[model samples]
Target: MKDNKQSEKDSSADNVDEYLQTLGNEDARERRYYSQEQPFSADEMTRLVNEERLNALLAQSDAFLSSLNSEIKDFNDEC
Candidate 1:
């Protein structure tokens, strides 16, 4: 598992190692954004949003939210 993670990390680094291979373009005519073309379809987005693993993050209990809120408030007061 550690080797797999290291391999994945190395692959990501190699992907990003190119010169100006990410984000923007030098030519205004070539410059574009993801907003111009949606990568995922609406159905895909809906499925992703409704995924059990993702939804689990939003399904916090009332007690958890209360504790989190108290901690946030305490931190704010301390600051």
Candidate 2:
């Protein structure tokens, strides 16, 4: 019974090692596929990030202008 328990533990450890190795192999394959198959470029990524930043800035500017206009309107009404 003791020997059987040891064998079971060894088998479980082996299975875990095998599973980890398989996961590593799959991750490597995915990285290779993305590197080879994807059309994404560093320059394009940079451009996209810059565009997003500019868009956010423009939105903030528009909101600020609208709020300032409203405040001016309220002041003119008080006058």
The lDDT values for all models are 0.74, 0.94
TM-scores for every candidate against the unseen true structure? 0.34, 0.47
Cα lDDT of model 1 by residue, 17-40, tens digit = 753454334343354543377588
Candidate 1 residue pairs in backbone clash:
none
lDDT tens digits, residue span 1-79, model 2:
9999999999999999999999999999999988898665989878767787789999999999999999999999999
The CA lDDT at 44 in model 1 is: 89
lDDT score at residue 6, model 1, on the 0-100 scale: 100
lDDT of 1 at 56: 75
**Candidate 2 backbone overlaps, count:** 0
Instruction: Return the top candidate by TM-score.
Output: 2
Give stretches of model 1 more than 4 Å off: 1-30, 33-35, 61-64, 71-79
RMSD of every candidate to native, in Å, equals 16.0, 8.2
Clashes of 1: 0
* Residue 74's lDDT in candidate 1: 100
Worst ten in a row by lDDT for model 2: 44-53
In candidate 1, what residue range of length 10 has the lowest lDDT sum? 22-31
